[model samples]
Target: MRLLEGVLIVVHIFWLLSFLFRFNAKVKISTNLVAFILMMIHFEAEGHRWQMGLTYVLFIFLTLLILKPFIQRNSKKVKLDSENKKKVKKFCGILFILIYSISSFALVIMMPVFQLPKPTGPFEVGMTSRHLIDESRSQNTISKQEAREIMIQIWYPAEVTDDNQKIQYEAFPYEEWSGTMEFIFSFPRFFFNYLKYNESNSIKDITVSDQESKYPILVFSHGFGSTRMQSYSQMEELASHGYFVVSVDHTNDAGYTKFPDGREVMNRADAYSYSFNIEDEKDVKTRSRDVSFVVDQLTKINKQDSQKLFTGKMDIDRIGVFGHSYGGSTAAQVLLDDPRFLSGINIDGPLHEPVASSRLKKPFMFILDDDYLFLTDEEIKYTNVTPEEFREYHNKITELADFHYEEGIKNDTYRLTFIAGDHYTFTDFPYLSPLLSLDINVDQFHQVMNQYILAFFNQYVKGEKTDPILLKEKKVDEFYYFETNIKN
Candidate 1:
């Protein structure tokens, strides 16, 4: 909880305890009113969240207590003179406060309104979005006029000076982004209404940096049923280091996307995107086309930008692509199908079909989540599956992973196994809510991860000197496996 919110909660508890201890009427009334005032201050200053619902209710009860004296001013009141009655009153009041406090504290801890970490780079970050429609490809048959629509957002290094404030303030939408994530995770919609308090690091529609002639480009695709900005931290980090990054929201495939015109699009992909079969491959193939379309549009923008903000600024020849989960597979697909992508990275994603079987010619980094990489016999024993079914499912998944590791490692691939890290760790989600995010220290992990990412792209896409972090296995946080395609 924030400072004022925390203070209000503590004050409320004290107010309850004061009544139980037979404090004077003025003392009790004053404390209760103080709590009520603090709550108002918290609502206006720190912002009220649903987590404070119980706190609000508790304060209302105190308000009723304060009004009870006035309501019963004419009625005869009998005091509880017995010691047993006084003890019972104290016990119940303490118990009630304890339960309410614990419940409210848990909610605040689980879903906090946090801020994105600052990018550890020299330049500031600027962002902008574009709504794209592919006229040739029809998306929905129910709507006769609708076509394949995509939302593309870009982040780039920017200049912030006295004359030019390349930092345009953009309001964070509590319903839109939070609702999208809740839909993906099956959480109740509007449960995270407090997300509006979360601060974004990128400023919108800002001027691009001109410190260099042209900025190398990095294109991004999100995980299945995930929004493109779900991984905004990495985008900002890259942009702050002088890289122009564009993220594509595969409309109808993303969890949710709202265009400038107020049209809302939600995921139309199969619920089981990780089926590890031909279905998964077909999904990857379809989403890869969106990335391709985005790339084509960027090329056009570089030549003639309608916005008149960034014209001929993209270094098209030095382009790279990276993604997480299913989008990771899309990156591999781009490395194979699109020659414009000089390099790529895959974060904890399983590759499917021809892409899995094909050798990647470009330099690529494969970051794997090793949380379940190894399991003991007892750990393997299932809670809800027959041993045979478990073995088959486990074997097939392992075979899928082995294919990517063996085939991908045959080329110039840098494979890093994140120890105890999970799929969401590769993105900005890890820093959003500590309880739902990764177990790792998010800022530290991202600091190291961003360094390696910058080094890999710099070396392959820009033909720059390689950073030593990529030279061999080293430990800055925890021990994890690291290797290259070439044998030492």
Candidate 2:
């Protein structure tokens, strides 16, 4: 809880106790005064949100009760018979305590505290978001605009400082962003109210760490209909380990994107229409272009004098691209199309038609969820399909997976599947809410994921091969399957 919130809770508890115990008039008035002051402070801090409605009502009632002592002093002095009066006071006190305790507990649960996992790497992370427009390409079916636009947030190693304040995880206003997500997912807005207070470990636009002369660049693309902030845990972890990570929000496709000029782009009907209508191949191809454009812009930033944050610090020659879901397919497409990216990681996303058939020569990794690799026969069958059609569909998907595996064997590639993983496991959604995740332990899943991602990048990009975790054979309890084509 925030400072004022804690104060308000404490003061309310004290006021309730004073009322129950029949404290002296001075003590009751003093407690009420302190609670009222704290209530006003909390209002100033938290604003007039419905979450604080109970606090407001409680304050008003307490104020009236405290003032009643003075107004009814002469008339309220009626003394009852000792035995009945004592019993009545005892029962009322117990009831009041029970009611107050439950109410307080409920209120706290409504606005629960949530936290991001701390980065285990040695260096601290700093981040900045930039708005980039690709004038060379026209807008897709989502927007009728002339140029394709994207918002890219970059996280890099930063010098740790005591004075630096941590940044908020979402790029847009917390309430607005949370509301947008609720609208898109059709959940109640209050379901995500706790997200507003979840702050990132990253500081905004701090000085890049000079521990190394240059850092490898890794670009991240989010799943379809997801914002760049969705994979913040992974990005921050990578950035802390001396990689300059860039996450792109494809405008109109992201859940909600806010540009510097206050222009808000939402994932509306146009965006979903294209996603649902277009072929996965075309969708990923367009997204790949966005990644390539981002690489080009980053190259310019590395070369140009005007780019302040990363001019001489970025190792343009050593670049990697990785993504989740549709974005994972985008990463593979980027590897196929752009020679600038040295490696790629595709997390739980199926390979599209042409890309599935093509061979990739660069070092690559495919982190699959168990369901992606082991779909049941019943799951593969369409509701209206004949036996032959079901067979064809199953064969087609299996062939794509087989081709991807064959390509992995031909090049330096790694394949890993988590036994308890599902599609959402590859992203941070599993860590955010248990209701949205598989039945597996989210913390363990995240730990294993971060370990391997860091190891892969460290070995391939930074040429550090000291990660022992990646060299071990797959343990059945930890992974459903694991394979690597690269020879040690």
Candidate 3:
């Protein structure tokens, strides 16, 4: 609960106690004053919806309590003829207080203040976001702009602070981020209001830790209609572990992209209107280009004379790329098209025709959800997939997996499937809300994901020996299946 909300609740409790016990005039007045002050504070602070509503009701009740003493003093008192009548009045008052107490306590408990799990890495994390415009490329007509624009958030290892007053974990302060999500997903705005309080384990623009001369770069792309901050937990974790992670928000494709100049770009309506029928091959190509352009910009930033941001801090030669859903396909395409990225990971994203058909020479990993696990025709029915659609979907996944396996025979490759994992599991959606994900241990899922991703990058990018966890042949409880083509 917020500070003001907590104060308001305490004041309400005091008022309830005073009313039931028939406290002295001075005590009643004190309670009323405190309640009114707390309510005013809550109003100014803009408490949660339930908190605000309850506070208003409590304010009215307290006002009536304060006026009761005045009314009693002015009006003639009526003596009850029978003792039973007085007892009945007292019983009713107690019953009402009981009911109110229970209801108010329930409301307070329901006002949830969700928090992100603390990152387990040794280093603290710092973040900064930048808007990059590719001058060489023209913006798509749907964007109504001149240059291709992308918003990116970068997370890196930071100096840990001992000051308790220092505000770590910077996040969206208001309803803007949640409002954009509600707009894209067509959900009630209040459903995501808690997101405004959601904070990552990363401070804003802290000085980079000097433990390492340079850190390996990891580029992340979000799923269709998702913002770069969608997978914030993962990015923060990676950064805490000494990786410089950059997450890109593809303008006009993401749900919302707010630039430094106060301009906001939303996903194009036409794009979603024809999404189902249109193959996302072009979209994949566009995102691939975006990633390539970002890589080029980072390279230039590393070599720039005046720019302090990431100057000489990026090990461009040890860069890796990864993404979720459509963005995952973009990662694979980037790896295939550009030789800059040493390796790539695709999280539950179907490979486009170009990527599936072509052979990849670099190390790669494919993390899949239960949906992509091999299924028989009879088993396919349980997946809620129509026969025709299942055929095409199954074939595409199989072909891509086969190609990856074949390449794995010559180069390092890994395929992992989580039986309980869903498409949204690859991102922070599962951790954000239980209703948005499948029935699975979200924390465990994240732990396994982070471990595997770090292991892959360690072995490929940093030339570290493979971790023992990655070498286990026996099926672990978290995974449905795990396969690797790397020769021992």
Candidate 4:
């Protein structure tokens, strides 16, 4: 048996002793609280809580049934054999304790056997993924505005096991605006503490196999108020298909981030509010420059790493950028500013505010939400702009960009039209939330999404036409819808 299971069994015994002693309410509450924490830690498998809750209910029922006869016999205050009463009490205690301990132990043991299945697919392996942070900039003396240095994570295919190097957890602070994420406004600070214990903190290094093959560079930008880890499914999918994908976290823009030293940086929503017009433009440009800087750093890693793990593996010339929401706008902006980025993909972002003024000379595609029209229609119609400004901004790139709409297909992507599902589906929250099951079979969605994303990069970056699955316009999976316009 595992050490955790043994400890849980011992805890059960202590709880039984407390019940027999008629422990104070506070003591009983504390013991139950400990049990709750233990159960959550070992809940490696999903749906375990309901199973455990059911067992607890049954145990309480049986305990009451067994104790009723004893209580009745003792109520008469009549003489009874002390030995017989002691035996009866002991038997009840042992029986309840045994049942509780056995149930908990068996659940822990059987978790691995009943683990959820992974997605079904074919993928190659030459990917490397890693998170990079400039810790020096996170110091308190630095104003959040002045803190241009950021935490960026790049996922790529790699073949080296530098075991001595440590892996880091998906460390984001939930304290500042956790309350805002859900409509129920509460203290964001308290949510930080709650989130820590709930999340799995396992840190595994960027693991990839066979480092010899060359792969193209792909830069990724996550949505607003989200950390770089939010799109991990897409990152891993691309890495597994033998491409180097780099993801960046715009500091202060993400919900919150906790460094290795336990220093927590919360979202500076106040700062965003103060200078919305100027700062938003400034920040997006900064993010684009950060992507360029990351590419430069990867070049350095190729030459300097003692293990020579990165040598000849980075295809510096063949780079691409893709992002969602605010990130999607950033992707387009980066492609416009940096000629090094060969192709670009944007997943459902408003073009009017961020990229309306920018013109693109390179190829770019848009994987738009059917709801993009709802998002932009009002602003585009009402916002005042000079004719020259509108023409120079909106009309410059009208012919250069392509749109692919995910609408009206008999699949999960079509069902995504139900507002809450659309924005969250592309994010890691889909996998994290219990509500995911209510919306769609998440595993199926992940499988189809991964396939198409990889196929797009493969065709554009590597000049290879692979995965004909994306060529179809009709629904093949209930998890997605398909539409595309190839720009002339």
Return the top candidate by lDDT.
1
lDDT per residue (tens digit) for residues 62-167 in model 4: 3564456566975766676598887888789878778877776665444221212221323332223343544333423344433445566555554436767654
Instruction: Residues 297-357, candidate 1: write the lDDT tens digits.
Output: 8889999999976788899899999998878878888887888888899876766666767
State the lDDT of candidate 3 residue by residue for 323-415, as single tens digits.
997888888889889998998999887777577667788888888886763456785554445668767766767666767765632467887
Report the poorest 10 consecutive residues by lDDT, candidate 4. Answer: 408-417
Residue pairs in clash, model 2: none
Better of 1 and 2 by lDDT: 1
Output the lDDT of residue 311, model 4: 66
TM-score of each: 0.90, 0.80, 0.81, 0.61
lDDT of each: 0.76, 0.73, 0.75, 0.55
Q: Candidate 2 lDDT, tens digit per residue, 1-488?
A: 45676567667777777877777878878888788777776666654445455666788888998778678978867776698888898788778767765676556554544466788888888888888888898875444557878889899998855567554443323544464566456677676665666677787888799899999999998887777887777888899999999999877667777778887766665322323212357778888889989988888888873658788899988998899877887888898999988878988776775676677777788887765634445743523445565556546655665566655435667777788858777666664555555478766777787788888888877878647766665757555566665543
Question: What TM-score should be assigned to candidate 2?
Answer: 0.80
Best by TM-score: 1
What is the overall TM-score of model 1 with all chains considered together? 0.90
Shift in Å, residue 224, candidate 1 = 1.1
How well does candidate 2 score on lDDT at residue 417? 77
Model 3 Cα shift for residue 186 (angstroms):
1.9
